[model samples]
Target chain A: MRRLTDVGALREAYDLVIVGAGPAGMAAAVEAAGQDRAVLVLDENPGPGGQIYRAIGTAPLRDPRVLGAAYWEGAALADAFAAAEVDYLPGATVWHLDDALEIGVSAGARSAVLPARRVILATGALERPMPLRGWTLPGVMSVGAGQALLKAQGIAPTGRVVLAGCGPLLWLYAAQCIAAGAAPSLILETTPRANWRGALRHLPAFLATPYARKGLALMARVRRHLRVVPHVAALAIDAEDGALRVTWAEGTAFTADHVLLHQGVVPTLNLARAAGCAIAWDEGNACFAPVTDAWGTASLPGIAVAGDGAGIAGAEAAALRGRLTALEALRALGVLDEAGRDARAAPHRAALARWSRGRAFLDALYRPAPHFCAAPPDAMACRCEEVTGAALRDAARMGATGPNQLKAFLRCGMGPCQGRMCGPTITETIAQERGIHPREVGYMRLRTPAKPITLGEFAALRKTEADRRAVERR
Target chain B: MFRRLPEPPARRIGFSLDGVAVQGAEGDTVAAALLALGRTACRETAVSGAPRGPYCMMGVCFDCLVVIDGLGNRQGCLVPLREGMVVETQHGRRDAAR
Candidate 1:
């Protein structure tokens, strides 16, 4: 792999610049370059594989079927990226993207600015937070984070761990943890077995893909070592003496050295919004995702969003979307005739439809528990404003209609972390109290410099960039 | 059987919880300290009349929320308590009337 010391020094622009080097970004880079466009894939991580394709160095397990479909597909995808003449920038965080397709990238202390004719955002998703008592203890971690830690550092937080959460990834993660020799104490699954009946109805689609069957078999194998408790929720966690104590909603408790929680995921859309792309609220996921067309083009003509940044489709869907976006970009650039674009996108569209159904089934089965937004009277809802659930309840009782009104009264969304953590719950709680839908509750209005930036850095960057632009204009 | 050694002395800090003066270890987040003290209902939900405490400790989950000093609704796990800091129980995402 070639490493560029200074990405800023590359003065030549590209036909397409894809942000995030995961499945979506890699797929886009390969497909776009095949159409003869100069493609660049930028990622914050040291490698091309995103979190899903972590543990790259670990040899593929002997059981091809056991390794699951995405595993083999990922290997093939990696090969595709390797062969493509694409400029792959690892460890580069694209901090800002302007509407004009100008991107500001930061790597460690150094920063660079790159321009592109078109931008594709595949930034992926972040795990949803599931808070419980004693969760702040040292050994508690998100399942995704734990997996990342294991993949990147080969370290396990504890010898015995409890994996709790809902969704397909939960079992997959449990299997990985067991393979790493850290036997999970138990698997507390919020997704009820009854929900699988709905998933089973979509079995034909799953059967068509050997990977899907392998994923299911892997889960079954992992079930032998780990006790799987369905339709249960982890209520509270407390650290006592030296061990961690976890309580479940069904009136059961267990003790372990560490607890791993996995809620669903929400797309990371801050960069898309920062670039002034139009966004819409996804009622299904209770989050805002970037608005994209059939071809993954965002509201802006030259920019497109794919993968989780566009919506929380899994890896397969993301790859398909990435290829579709590339085809669209190629056709727009007159490289591919209409016939070519149509032929390439037809099979992808079919795959996307099949994947969407499976995802929808999973969504309904593992929908956030009804009481997810229910905070205790004294439980803190907005960590930023120090607002408690009780205080918000009082305001709601007094006719607080939405998050905006609740914010005005309690300053719930006005904190350094912004509302990324608390906004969904707050909106849901307000809607439930006022007898309204979450979408009707609206989202917290975000102002630019979406992430927290030190005043010094902001001022310095603004002045330097402004002077440079003025010189260029002259 | 070899007996496990006792935990070493923890670094402690003083802070107020809901107007009550309390002391916690340096490594303990405000939420951990509060939970260790058996304060289960850290905050209330605005709608469903459900109780919530700490859920995920890693900054991702927003469950363990408490009022610290003058700020309202801060993640207890993420914040380290300072000496003489005023921590209060949050009610429905706001401070209770004095």
Candidate 2:
């Protein structure tokens, strides 16, 4: 595998270019590489495994049980990707993506334009906006950030740390903390009420499936030592006496050096939306996702999305989907005829079906905390601009229809996160205030340069004198 | 305050934080290095001048912005800390800071 850095080194065109080196992107790369298609995988991180399998390359984690058996399985995937024929571009930020499969990337001080016949976006997910009182305080953090700290460098809160909100990842991190011989001061779980009435329909499917057993086991392990508080209605973080004072609806309060917050995760949809893909609101996960078919095809013919980027179907299902997408791409490229592609896709599809059966249950079971639907008036909705829920509600009253209009009225999604940290919260607030469906309200319209790029990096994109001339003419 | 088990930081990677020599481990990012040193406030708000630290170590929150080796507005969590690397707490927007 070749590592590309210079903009001058990128091939004029790739048969397939995959954005994100996560489970889906790398799995797709491995499959496409085996099929002899010229492939390229780009990631902002230094390694291949995405959030779920972070640090798989460098970490030979001394104890697999520390992170868990599911995480340890990523080692084989990384090894397979390492041995594959795909070209990997690490530390490369794919900021801009067009409908024609052209990708604008910034690597170090350099920039490059990658033109691809077909593009697969495995762009992954981001934590849903968790806006509570005093969250802007210095010590508050997302649970994902804590887990990343542990994964990247084995860092954990040595002092009193309170873990709040709900998600399997939160419990998994709690279990990891317990395994590492440390425990949180408290676990404030805003666990969603189980929709047993609506969920009975999916019971047969979940019973026959082995999904969420890992989550259950992690919860079991965490309950042994940590004091778990379930179903926190009102939550707030305040800086009191040099520590984060966490208070919930029932008035239970605790002070810790650090307060970690999480709701769940939503799709990273900047690339897909910028590529003009049709995004539909996923009712199950209570978030927006690019409307993608079984084979990972988006609304556009040449563009596809996989993994958490397409929807929130954990890691195992993402790998299967990556394989399915590669097969479909091969068939589209005329390399594998229809029958060959179908035969290859059959097993992957079946595996995805079994994995997906458990997915709906988790999505419904862990739907974001109810308060998000109508957050308190003063809660911070946008972390970047510091827009409050009250501000969003004011805009909604002024006939601001959706996220796009709110962006003009209050500058909600125009910050560095590019709406990732604020989109869900604003959408929920506006929808609730207007008494409409979140789907009808829609999400922020994303643009190019998804991540920040320095002007110097932009100038470096002119790789040649002809490019310089073209820029001058423009 | 946070250290990995069964390993004593492997080896020290020294860097400068606002002209002071700071010792960081090989695997530590600039933000992690700062955190390890108990320096919680990364920068002050442009509007309020209120101190803010690295909330989300994952590059989503832009709160971790710091000047790395004269390159301002770099995400401390995104860039890996290296020996002799100079980093300063970013004051405001890069242009305004300049």
- Poorly placed runs, candidate 2 (over 4 Å): A194-196, A211-213, A373-375, A463-474, B93-98
User: Clashes in model 2: which pairs?
Assistant: none
Each candidate's fnat: 0.05, 0.63
* TM-score of chain A by itself in each prediction: 0.85, 0.95
Task: Tell how far residue B25 is off in model 1, in angstroms.
Answer: 30
Cα lDDT tens digits for candidate 2, A3-100: 77655677777889888888899888888886667888888887778888888866534677788788888888888889989888887888888887
| CAPRI grade of model 1 | incorrect
**Count of backbone collisions in candidate 2:** 0
- TM-score of every prediction relative to native: 0.74, 0.95
Share of native C-alpha contacts between chains A and B (below 8 angstroms) recovered by candidate 1: 0.05
DockQ of each: 0.05, 0.64
lDDT of 1 at A146: 57
What is the iRMSD in Å for candidate 1?
10.9
